[model samples]
Target: MAQRVFITAGAGGIGKVIAETYAAQGAQVYVCDQDHRALESLRDGITGSCVDVTDEAALDDWLQAGLAVLGGCDVLINNAGIAGQADPVEALDLAQWKKCLAVNLDAQMITCRAIAPVMKRQKSGAIINLSSTSGLFGAPFRAPYAAAKWAVIGFTKTIATELGPYGIRCNAICPGAVSGDRMDRVLAAEAQARGVTPQDVFEDYASGSSLRRFAEPEEIAQLCVYLSSDAAKFVSGQAIAVDGNTETYHSV
Candidate 1:
């Protein structure tokens, strides 16, 4: 049987690549994202709905509807996230912090909550949560994003232990400075906050990694496919980094 895979925020960026990669491997891919146009533009093998991950009710609805169509989910990837406000901790806004946590952290919990029962009954499934290198190290200007990502690692491990008896595996993927429009926007924001050119900020980020370059979206997507495959059935509760061996975090 073809694998049934569900992904959040799969309409664009890294999520899009992940969805497409699964589809290419003949998996039944269903995704949800906030961008209606991106959802509409998805290729034939991939299907998606417009959903704001922060909206719990809407997210639940999307999951239920997807479950109905896919029959059952073999893999669930929590890929929705935002690069929250780029500012000092003292200058941060409470609303922005909440928003970041809502999408990056809360939504993952919501989806996992909804899917756990299904997986438990099947006695086999994979859950991949997208974390970040920031989760492993201190991200100077991105407190909310970093905090939420750190929490994802903890959440992934807890669930792995809780679900292991039932044959469910959970893991977190930590990608650093992925090369994409999203990273472009993040660089622009950090640059503006630091009063430097975007190029300067980009260089700093690249330099932070031992590889001295940003990761390709396909690189991250490939890992998602691997983790969800039978090959990685024993790999649970691991916070794997795809950041080209990050040496240091860029400073403000």
Candidate 2:
């Protein structure tokens, strides 16, 4: 039988790829994103909804609505996140920091709380969260992003512990420098912040990776799909790094 998969930030990037990969594998895929237009533009076979995951009530409603359409959710990819304020601590905007934490950390907790009952009732499920190398280490100018992502790892582990008896597995994926428009934007932002060329920042990021390159979204999607499948049934409370050995060399 096909599984029902619910993915946050499913409109594009790694989220979109994850949805498509699972759908191709015969799962019923439902995706949620704040960008309605982008969600609507996705190819066939995906059920997309507009959801701002940081808003607890709004996200709960959206998740419930998705469950209704999906029949039930066997897998959830907590992929919604933002590259929050990037600047020195003294100049960092509190609003941006709070907003980042709201989406990247708090929203994950709220969504898990809302879905735990359903997963427990069903007696099985898998939750895959998107973390970052920044979460595992320190980044020079990404205090907010790092802080929230670190929290996600801790959150995933805690839930895994509590949910294990219920047969609901929880794990996290730490990806490094994924290639996409979002990555381009990040490079541009870093360039602006450091007063260097975009290529310079890209080189610096790639230099630490063992592959000497950024990962494609499909690569990360493959890992997510595997974790959601029966092949990884015993995996839980693990933060798997999908980076090309970047964490070993890079502090962030």
Instruction: Give the candidate number with the greatest TM-score.
Output: 1
lDDT string, candidate 2, 116-147, tens digits: 99999999999999999888888877899999
lDDT of 1: 0.92
| Model 1 misplaced stretches (Cα beyond 4 Å) | 189-199
> On residues 96-173, what C-alpha lDDT tens digit does candidate 1 reach at each position?
999999999999999999999999999999999999988999888889989999999999999999999999999999
Best by lDDT: 1
Q: All candidates' lDDT scores? A: 0.92, 0.88
- Residue 251 CA error for candidate 2 (Å)? 8.4
**lDDT value for model 2:** 0.88
Cα displacement (Å) at residue 159, model 1: 0.2
